[model samples]
Target chain A: MLTKRIIPCLDIKDGRTVKGVNFVNIRDAGDPVELGSAYAQQGADELVFLDISATNEERKTFASLVRDIAKHINIPFTVGGGISAVADVAPLLEAGADKVSVNSAAVRNPGLIDELSKAFGAQCIVLAIDARRVDDQWTVHTHGGKKATEKKLFEWAKEGQDRGAGEILFTSMDHDGTKSGFAIDPLARLNAILSIPVIASGGAGNKEHFIGAFKEGKADAALAASIFHFGEVKIPELKSFLKQQAIHIR
Target chain B: MKLAIIKYNAGNIQSVSFALERLGVDFHITDNAEEIKTADKVIFPGVGEASTTMKYLRDRKLDLVIRDLKQPVLGICLGMQLMCTFSEENATECLGIFDESVKLFKPTAQDQKVPHMGWNQLRLKDSWLDPSLEGEFIYFVHSYYVPVNPNTAASTDYIVPFSAAMKRDNFHAVQFHPEKSAEAGERVLKSFLK
Candidate 1:
């Protein structure tokens, strides 16, 4: 059986791992390579690094960081942020990233997903959606949630899948940094609508939240950052907890 | 021992190189027919459309070269599919190292997904690579699979039981990406190296 994946996300700026609350007030976590290696050792099914730095030089730094991480970790890892064109993907894959996630770029031009999935195969393209509840309906937000688009969250997700995105990383802006738990209703809706895997992100305060993500939210994978980065929750401990709940963790 | 990974336009060969790197195995990633022929072992790894990739290989005449390799050779995912007799993917003819046809996976139920992405157990038949991998979970990601046949070294069931691994003569292929499968996967690759 395909197990439910527990992923630790690293938000990197200038090649260093960082975490923030609700996309602001960022703080340093550690070196991305060291942290990623530790997560793989502790049984993180996968790792995701978002290059929050959207500059050319930092992209180079991120590429080298991916190379460094791949040297130490055997499991699959994904890199995202600032990836726009088809040319942006090859260097990262060459540096050993198994998959690449596109958010703002994909939203701006939905065709990029088609182009990417065509060029690199469907398995390598992930569509990361950052959303928040607006007037009782989820709205797609980009630019780290500072900007909101007219696209409805559910419709946009479906379109992304149609464009050949293999997976969806849906992060709830309302639940993010709050630790109040995932926005289960929206997550379950998204999971039900898409045949591909859905990874629930944000608002994982305790072990129970993860259980809720898999059980109530119907997420195929759960991604958390602050809790795992700050050592508030260890991956092994979380896996055992999920395993006890019969979640079939990896 | 020198190992050569047959390079093409396909993506994700880096994972294979990294897997070999972890095992302390040195290798060269080259498409040169002579380089491939001289290697102690050759790994054909790819992630691309079969028809287009086959055209690329045939253009370079690497297709015939791969068919004649005497040393142990491993084909992964798309590489495995291309080594078969033919592929339903774009209706392409392949290297025919193993006389099996690749077909698209048909999910029987509403919830059963195609692509078979994620970890599943391996049921091994006897092979020099390792029978101990039977019942072990390995990672797989593909929309097409090779049906079970005489050359099948191991099998895995998704929507149907299919060839998880294949062996005939000195050519071997696995449908799964052993590099992405953690410890059990590394063990399988280590056995291949041995």
Candidate 2:
């Protein structure tokens, strides 16, 4: 039986983990490798590292960081942010990233998905969409939610799957950082339309929100950042909670 | 013991290599016939279109070399699919290490997805690979699969029950990626090398 996955996302800026993580096992909050290994020890199904660094030197640092994390952590990890072309992917994969998430790049040139999917495979390409509810419809946002595109959330998600994306990481900007809950309605909407797995991202505060994402929103996986980074909700405790609620978790 | 991963035009070899590195096992990723034949254990791994990869192997004459490897061999994902009799992936004939065919998943229900991605449990049968992994959740990311057959060492249910692990004589193949599957997967890989 396929179980719902729980993923903790880390943001990297200037070769360091952005959100300060506080955990007894993890002493270096800035070190991604230490944080990733600690999360894996706590039974995080997978980890996503979004490189928010902009400079060329920091990109090099991110590469080595990815290499180091792959050496230390046993679970799969994804690297995202600033991936623009086919040439950009091999270096990261070689650096030990299991999958690479494409957001603004895919929006700029959708053919990159097909090319990456061809060179690698669909399983290695994750299409990430940052969306915000505009009026009654959800609109796609790019540049880390700075720019909004005409692409509707559901339409872009469908296109993502059709263009050979293995999964869709749907993040709601409205719900992000609020910790109110996930954008459940849109997540369920996206889940209903797409055949591929939908990873619900943004706005996970407590364990109950995770339950809402899995049970009510019908997400294949729920991804959060600060909630996990701050040690508000440990992965094992959340999984146990979900299990008690009869939700299959890994 | 020296272990070698069969290198081809495929993805995910780095992840496998990293897994081995974590286990403190030294390995070589090569396409050379002699190097593969000399290794104590050879892992055939791939993640690409079947027909094109087959063509690449045949062009390099690796197909013949791999068919003759007598040492214990393990194939992961696309490697396992290529080890079968034939694959519906591109209507291509495979290495035929196991007398079975690979076909794309046809989801029984409407919402059931193809490509069957994510963590799934295995109903393991007695095998030398690892008895502990029986009913253990492992990672899988593929669309095509081999059906339940005589070679099946373990079975899993997605839309329908399919072979998650297969074994025949010295050849062992798994439809899942043990390299990416964390703790339980590390145990399975360690057992395979043992």
Candidate 2: tens digits of C-alpha lDDT, residues B73-141 = 999999999999899998999999889989899877645776787889988877666787777989988
Q: Among the candidates, what TM-score does chain A have in each?
A: 0.94, 0.98
Residue-level lDDT tens digits of model 2 in A1-250 = 7889899999998779998777775578888888888898888988999999888888888888888888888888899989999898899998888899999999989989999988888888999999998887799999889898999999999998999998999999999999999999998888788888889998888999988998889999999998888889988899999999999887
The structural similarity of chain B in model 2 to the true chain B, as TM-score, is: 0.97
lDDT of each: 0.86, 0.89
Give the DockQ-based CAPRI class for model 1: medium
Q: What TM-score does chain B get in every candidate?
A: 0.97, 0.97
**Which regions in candidate 2 have their CA more than 4 angstroms from the true location?**
none
Tell me how far the alpha carbon of residue A131 in candidate 1 is from the true structure, in angstroms, after superposition.
1.0
* Candidate 2 residue pairs in backbone clash: none
Candidate 1 structure quality by residue, lDDT tens digits, A1-250: 6678888999998888777423212332367776777777788888999898867887788888888887778788899989999999988988889899999999899999999999888888999999998998899999988899998999999999999999999999998999989889998888778888888998999989988888888888899998887778888999998889998765
Residue A27 shift from truth in candidate 1, angstroms: 18
Cα TM-score of candidate 1 = 0.94
Tens-place lDDT digits, model 1, residues B94-161: 99888888999887664456667777788888865576787887888889999999888888888899
Best candidate according to TM-score? 2
Candidate 2: C-alpha lDDT? 0.89
